[model samples]
Target: MAPDDIDATLGAAWHDDSPWDLLTRLCAFDDRLGGGPGERHAADLVADELDSLSLDPRIEPFGMQRWTRGHTAFSVHPSDERSREFEAVALPYSPAADLRAPLVDVGHGTPAEVEAAAVEGAIAVASTDSPAGERHTHRMEKLGHAVAAGARGFVFHNHVRGQLPPTGALQFGHEAPIPGVGVSHETGAWLREYAAEDEEASLRVDATTDDGESRNVVAKLGPESDAEVLVLAHYDSHDVGEGALDNGCGVAVALAATRLLTEFDLDSQVQVAAVGCEELGLLGSAALADSLDLDRVKAVVNVDGAGRFRNLRALTHTSEAMTAVAERVAEESGQPIATAEGPHPYSDHWPFLRRGIPALQLHSRTPGGGGEWDRGFTHTRADTRDKVDPRNLRTHAMLTALLVRDLSTTDPDRVDTDALRETLREAGAEPGMRAAEVWPPDWD
Candidate 1:
């Protein structure tokens, strides 16, 4: 088929009002964790829609160690004997802890300060800023330092406007040893001042963990082929936000691309994965990565937080050859490609990268070096569909279709493993990890 013919078909499929309505309806379903109406309802609705497309959609069930917000309330007591004033909402996944211990003011929770302070069993109030460094890295390091210093809990003061605290699985790949939460800048500042003035500050957090099953919705186009291209997006959102730009937009692009691919018969196969529990330490992607036959997989193109902006940001841990391929596709599609260093831990692509598979995470750039839009709205209730740009969505879908079509048609055997190995070694992945592991039996 001609390129213009494909463009026309994709334009018609994506430009219509139906795609927007479908996106709106999907966004409306609350898919937050912990027995909320969103998760199951959204999965069911997506499954129904995929079936309507005459595609074989299946819900692959898996267990997730889930956390939910239990009864939680925090208050600040002033030294002048005024009644306690509640300062901030407890973050999701906060551990259950009750201590009236004296508060300590630690600026930025750095290693040196944490080592210097008497912080055992005390609520550590810290600023979320670095003197002169990468703010996200510095903040995460501070969090780790606080948890190590025997601090019972944390109160992070938001330094930037509209900033929300980090929540869910404290460490990216492991459980956090202590419960942590974020407070508004005003609350954090007051706590800091109260501590400095020798006034008492106290906080109590209540939370719970429930064992439950979450699912990865898989829709495959084409027959069982040895070589496959996997496309992914997370369907689950933070408890507070609707997850429109964070992922609802991504889901829309993936779904729209899948629909377009279905219209044409192809030599190779495409697997669309709508992952669950990505907000919780990339659980869904980890599960899917463990189950796949990596030897036969050609490449992984993850569409996360796409179609909401004009710029196209492509993060990859793939070979330069693969990067060149992606760059070529972006050039042809009239999109600028922003390349980043290997494997970002924030999205579903991390797990695949860990397993030595070539993977890419595609998203839009946030203004003023704020990282990404979802980072701004992460774990907050303000994330909604109104933030999405339909033009961005259409462009992402078009690019994805072109990339998948090209990769699927290309011979997997033609890929250069030696060059790929060198690339992985330079990227710090140990040799032999690129060899796909044995597929886990009984992928339940």
Candidate 2:
């Protein structure tokens, strides 16, 4: 296609309504959890869209252990006659238990704090906010610390305001050992005050866990090639909020890019993956990675969190070649692209990255801060459709389309597992990886 023709196509991509329509439809479902009703609905819609483009998409089912949230409550006891109950939500994969124990508030709930507090046979209270100059502590890490300290239960207090209780997974690959719940910052403050006065708190959580199934949606654009560029985004989300920001935008961006790219022939194959079960874990992406012949995969562009801001940011982990490509695309498009140099194994791209495949994680830029950012809306009930803007969504899709076009022509240098491990150590990401128990056991 000529440069002028390419320009016209991209401009037309801005006016596309399929992406926004899909986003709205996805947000309407409440069961987007892996293998849940929402996931099935989302997969059907994506497959239908791909069929319209003659992509012949298929739904690949995978086994996953899923959980359902139930009743959870936290109460503070100043005395036998005085008690206060606060709003809370159970963390995913937390064991279903109804037990009461003394609560001890451990600020930020780091390993050291858990060690310092008398947490044996008690419920440990931890803040979700990380310390200054330190990385945000993973929910699993905090739960692990509490469990190691002999704590019978765990409670997470959000740092941001607005009565939003933060919820996240406390298990990595297995079910959590104890019950875990999240509370708002205001509730946390009450717990802290009671702790100062030498008071006790009680927590009771009743959740349900069972073996379940989920799937990954796969569609192909352009002709078959030896190497394909993998485009991935999760359609599953937490059950609390509409999940509009955590991943609804991600699906929209992927659809928009795929819709536009299908209009013209590409240099290589593009496998559009709308994965499921990311909220529980990267189950869908993991299944796809396990099934793929790695040699046939050239590069991966995983959009987990995009369209929340006007500009798109790429986290290029130890991939100098991909960094150069992103830079070139940014220059040519006259669009500012933010770049972060680090290794993060929490998203869908980690499975591919660990295997030495060059990958990019697309997300919106957050303010510079180790803590104190206004992220209370994430993982909470406040993440609604209003938070997403159409303009940002369209711009991000155009940028993604350009990236797909640019990355298809280049073959990335593969970094071996040892080199990848070394890169993580040098980047100071090893500790977090170890804490999350995602570090390759063989590497150690």
Candidate 3:
């Protein structure tokens, strides 16, 4: 992008409040779970915004077997005292189950630790985060390991406090073999204490499983070209909170950027895609990858971490073109944007990245940053409208507009298959992918 164009875009971005308005509209819905009404509303909002720009937007709907939450009961049965029950939520995709077994604390619940503890016939408990110097452990990995070891059930505790219980899916688009639930940080500590002495625990989870549908809003901009740049965000959020941070912020930022970029000329088209069902696993994007012509996609920039903070960073995933643009934009705009060269199969970008496409997962730079995986308040009940700042939205929209413009003109150095696999292996993504059953994408 030229300096003249950069200044022009910045001038337009300084006074923009449209992103905050879009975010407010998105936050009005309590939860945007995949295949739910909230997600459909969000998808329609994005399409309407794009239609206002004369960009012919389309909603691509897909179907899947969905999970509906019901009552979940968990209690500790000490021999000498009355049973104590705590508040918890059933993990999505957890099957209907009831069991009473010994509660075993498998700290971090890595595969090796779960095996060493001999937790067969017991309900294994694990933390949301990995140990110091260890890669972040996902809830699905912990749950999968427990079931593999013949554990009757699984309990995941949030690493963050303030009574927030982390909510994520058990298995990708399928009923998990055993029951799973999440508890607050403080409650998990109490459970560990109880495990040392009176370890008996009884758990019951009930739910209605059925078929459902979800939609993705997609719009095309700029003149037709051989390959296009994919700008992506997910409209679906977890059922636990308003989802302002995890993805509401992301979709809003993407809309604001698309609104401005409609007027700019580009060498290639930019496809704005608001996918659904990311929280239940990357179901929407996975479906898209299976259907779209991968050969015509030059790059993918997934907006997942913007608008919550002032500074933005990109997980470049070994894409040289992406890393260069991130650094160039920060230097040119005088913004403190950081770039990480590793890959983690956690967000909407994973589908494209795994297929040797140049992919970037853009997120807010973690404040007081130093390899902290959890960003305090996402995926919990506290992820509300008050947590986002309007100023951050405008700033990110300007920077993203510039990044997309640059990617449109520059050809990406696609990541090699073996090297990409090694990068994922080094970043500890293999275990989580294997657990979620989304690993070894068709490209492998």
For every candidate structure, what is the RMSD over all alpha carbons to the true structure, in angstroms?
A: 5.3, 1.9, 1.6
Best candidate, TM-score: 3
lDDT of 1 by residue, 33-103 (tens): 53356877777777877887887789887877667666656666675777466545555456677756667
Candidate 2 per-residue lDDT over residues 297-404, each given as its tens digit? 989999988887667888887788778878988999999887876667888998898888988988885445323233537789888888888888889888898888
Q: Rank the candidates by lDDT, best first.
A: 3, 2, 1
TM-score of each: 0.84, 0.95, 0.96
Query: Which ranking of candidates, highest TM-score first?
Result: 3, 2, 1
Q: Predict model 1's lDDT versus the native.
A: 0.67
TM-score of 1: 0.84
Error of 1 at 336 (Å): 2.3
Per-residue CA lDDT of candidate 3, range 26-52, in tens?
989867998888888988988998998
Better of 1 and 2 by TM-score: 2
Colliding pairs, model 3: 305-363, 305-364
Where is the poorest 10-residue window by lDDT in model 1? 435-444
| Local error of candidate 3 at residue 298 (angstroms) | 0.6
lDDT (C-alpha) at residue 78 in model 3: 83
